[model samples]
Target: MKNKDPKANFGIELDESIQIDGVSATATKFGESFRGIFRWQQSFFKLVWKQAIIYYIIYVSITLFYSFALDSGNQANFDAITSYLARYTSSLPVVLLLGFFTSTALNRWFSIMASMPGTNRPIALYVASLKEDAADGCARVDLYIRYVLLMWLLTFRIVCKPLRKRYPSLMSIQAAGFLRDHERLLLEKHKEQPGGSSKTFPLVVYDWLNILLRDTCQKGYFSVANDFGRNIDAIQVLKKGGGNVIKFASKNVPVALIQAVTLAIYCYGVVSVLSHQIEKHYLTSVLSGYFPLPYALPFFFYYAWLKVGRIAIDPFGSDEDDIDILNIFDCHINGAMRLRNCYGVKITIPSTDRSAFSLS
Candidate 1:
C-alpha cells in the first residue's frame, strides 16, 4: 500500500484551497468587468463620441425643457399629451421588435461564419493521400499544394474587403511569395482584357489544380478513384464555400427592416423621455425628485441594444467589431505551411519584388 501520511493529505487539501481561492478571484474580476457601467465608454463609443453626445444632448434638452421651462403649473395638459403619445405607441412592443431583429442579425452573422471554411483538414487529407516515386515528385507536389492554398487566399480576398485592400493587385500577391512570377504572367495573359483579376485568379488556380490532378493520375502517382477524385470533390467543396461567402457578402438585411426598427427605437426614446417628464411634473414628489433617472436609464439601455444590433447586421466589414479577415487568412497560410512541414518538403519562392515588404 502507498504511504498516506496525515501531513501529505493536509498539504494536498491546502493546495486545493489555494486553487479555489485563485478561481474565486478570477470570477470576481470577470464579474466586475462585465457589469461595469463604464464598459460602454471603452468600445467603438470612445472613437465616435460625437454621435453619443448628440443622443444625450437631445435627451437632456427634453428633460430640461419639461422639468423647468414647460408649464409645470399646468400638469393636466402635459399629462394628456404624454398619455396620448404613450397610448398610440407603447415602448414594450418596440423593445420586443428590437430584440427579435437583433436575434435575426446574430443568426445571419453565425451562418456567414459557418459558410466560410477555416480548417485545413481536407487539404491535409488530399496531400497525405498522394504517393510519388518519380524524381522531383516532392517539388511537383509542393507546387500543387501551394496553388491550392493560394487559390483559397485569393477566394477570400475577393469576398473580404479588408483582404482585397491588403492585396489590391496580382503583382502585390506575387510579391508576397503566394504567387510566382511565371504564374502571375500566365494569369495576366489569360485575362480577356486588363480587368477582373480577383475573379479570374481563382479560376486560373482551379484550372491548374485540375491539370495537376490529371497529370498525377496519369503518371501512376495515385489512383483517380482514391485520391484525385476525392481532391476534386474537396476543391468543389471549397468552391461552394467561396460561392456562399460571396453570396452572403453581396446580400444584407433588408434596408427597410433596419430602418423601421431603428425608427421605432428613436421614437420610443423620445416618448419615454416625455412620459418620465409627465410623471415628474404630476406624480408624487418622491418619484419626481428622480426625474431624469427614469428617462436616462431606459434611453441608455435602448441605445446600447440598438447599436449592438447594427454592428451585428454587417459583421464582415472594417468596423472594430467585424470579423478579423486578415487573422482568418493567416490561419490558412499557417496551416498550409504546417502541412508542408509535416511532409518533410522544403521549397522557396524567390522574392523578385521588394515593394511587398512594406505591404507585409
Candidate 2:
C-alpha cells in the first residue's frame, strides 16, 4: 500500500504503484559485489579447510591432555581436566554464536561507512582502516562479538536439517519482485515531484533502493522466508512494518539471540558425546589411536559442512552470482559525478579505464 502524503520521508512511503521486473539496478550491483567476495570456490574451500584444521588441532591437544589426566588417576588432576574440557565444550557454541553476530555487525558497519559520501574508498581499505583505529576499540570489540555470533549461527544452521529445509528459490524471486515493484514506484514519485533535481532524483532513488534492498533481501525473518520457503509467522510482522526496514531491525536481534542459544545447546551435546567416547575408551589399547581420530572427525565435518553451505546459500558472493559489485559501484559513482556536474560542481576522474575496475 502506498502512503498518500509525499512528505513522509521518515519511513518508506510509496506514493505510486508500479510493477517492475527483477531486482533494482542498485540491488543487482550490491548483490554482485557480495557474491564476488563470498562465491569463489577455491577461496571458500581454503577458508573452510583452514578453520577445520585449526579446530582439529585444538581438539586433538585437549583430548590428549584429558586422556593423560584420566590415566594418571590423580583425583585433583582428573577433576581439573574434566572441568576444563567441559568449559571448552560449553564455550564452543558461544564462540560460534559470537562469530556470526560480529560478522553481520561488521558487514553492516562497513556497508554504512562505505555508503557515506566522504568515504569513497574501497571496501577492503575501509575494513583495514577501521581495524587500525585504536580509538574505535569498543566498536571493534562489538564487531568482533557480532562476527563470532554470525559464524556460530551460520555453522549451526548449516548442520540443522530444519534450517536447511527453509531455503528455496521461488521465495527469492518473489521477494525480488516485491522489491523491484516498490523501488519503481518510489522512482516515479521522485520524478513527478516538483523542483526535484533530475540528477539528484536518480542518485537519491539509488541510495534509497540500496537501503531498502538491504532491509528486505539481505538477511533476517523476511529474507529467511523469502529465500527459503519457511512457513515462519514473522513474515506477517514484516509486511506489517509497511516496508522491510522495521522488520529487519525488529527481527534480527531476536534471531541472533535464538541462534546463539541453539549453538550453545549444539556444542554441549557434541562435548558430552566426545567426553563419553573418551571415557569409554580410556586406558585401553584402542585409546592411543581410536580416540584421536574420532575426536577430530566431528569438528572437522562440522566446519567443512559450514563452509560448503555458506558457499551454496550465499553464492552471490561468488563469481557466478547474478550481481556484480564493481559495476554497481561504478554506476553509482558515475551517477553521483553526473549529478555533481549538473550542479556545476567540478570533479575529476582518475582514469576512465581504471574507474570501473574490480578490486579482485
Candidate 3:
C-alpha cells in the first residue's frame, strides 16, 4: 500500500498504521522492500485461506469415502469418472477468462480514481478569480466551496458506506457545517417534490450553485469579455465528475460475466479434486490417494486472482483493499481550508532592479 500524502492529509490526525512509513520509497528495493507476502492485510493468503481450507476439507472427505467406503465396482466407476475429468480440465479456458476479467477491473479502478473530485481544484480557481481588499475574496469563495463540498457529500454518501455512516443524515451534515438549517429543510422538502427523489438533491444543490455563479458573474466579478464564465465551467466540470462517479457506481459488471467466472473457478476446483490424485505407481498402483497439496497452491492463486478482480471491479467498498474514500474527502476539506488562507498576500517588485546576470 502507498503512504497517504502528508501534504494533503494536513491537520487531520488519522491512525499511524494507515500511513505506512516507506512503502512508495522502498517498493523497488527488492531485497529491502516488497515484503507484502509477509503482510496479513490485503495478502493473497489472507484473501484465499478460508476458501483453501474448505476446499481441503471436502477433498479429505472425498478421499476417505474413496479409500474406505468404496467397493471394487464403485471404485472402478470412480476411476472412470476421474479419468474423464482429467482429460478435459485442461480445456476450461480459465486462464483467458480470468486474464481478461482482472485487467478490465483494474482499468475501471483507475478510471474511478481519475473521476474522483479533489476539492482544492475549484477553490484554487475561485480564490484567484475573485478580487477584494485583503482576503475578502477568499472569504467569498469559501461560501461557494462549502456548497460544492456539500453537494459532493450529498451524492457520495449514497454511494459510499463510510461517508453515509459519517454523516448519517442531512441533519448531521448541518451540524458539521456542510448543510445550513434552511438548506436542509429545502433539500428535504424538494426530495418530496413530484420530480425529485433523495438522489436528485445534488441537482437541486447544483441549480443553487448555478444561481450563485450567474449572480456573481452578472455583478462583473470577472471582466465580461475575458474570463467571466470560468467558474461556470468549473462547476460544470465538478458536476460532470460527480455524475461520472455515480454512473460507474450504478452500472456494474454484468452478472453473467461474474457468474461465469465464479462457476468456472469452483467447477474446476470440484472436477480437479475428482481426478487429480497422487500416484506412487499406477500399473500395480501403490499409493493412489487424494494428496491435495498440488491443488492447494494453484487453487489459492486462482481464487486470489478472481477475488482481486472482484475487489477492483467496485473499489468503492470499505474493505482493506478498497479505496479509502473517507480519507480523500478529509484530505480535500483540509487542503481547501489551507489553500483558502494562503492567497491575497502582499508582494513587492522594484521597478529599477536589474537582472542578476546583467553585465553593465
Best by lDDT: 3
Q: Candidate 1: where is the Cα deviation over 4 Å?
A: 1-53, 67-79, 89-93, 189-197, 223-225, 278-291, 344-360
What local distance difference test score does each model get? 0.66, 0.37, 0.74
lDDT per residue for candidate 1 within 1-360, as digits (tens), equals 012132232111122212321123444554654443344533545544564566566656655566677675555677678678767555356777788889888888878877875437555765676663556566765787678777877787766778888789888888777789889888778775667555767777888888987887787776345787887787777777777877786788888888888888778766765664334434653354344555556666667677778887776678766776665566556566556656635468876777656643
lDDT of 2 by residue, 51-158 (tens): 546555655665566656546565456556555766676446544654564566445433422322211121112122222323443343233222222222222222
Q: Which structure is stronger by TM-score: 1 or 3?
A: 3
Per-residue lDDT of 345 in model 3:
60
Q: In order, what is each prediction's RMSD in angstroms?
A: 13.8, 22.1, 5.1
Model 2 misplaced regions, further than 4 Å: 1-47, 66-254, 265-291, 304-323, 327-360
Q: Please report, as a residue range, the 10-residue window in candidate 2 with the lowest summed lDDT.
A: 117-126
TM-score of 1: 0.73
Question: Candidates sorted by lDDT, descending order?
Answer: 3, 1, 2
For candidate 1, the 10 contiguous residues with the lowest summed lDDT are 9-18
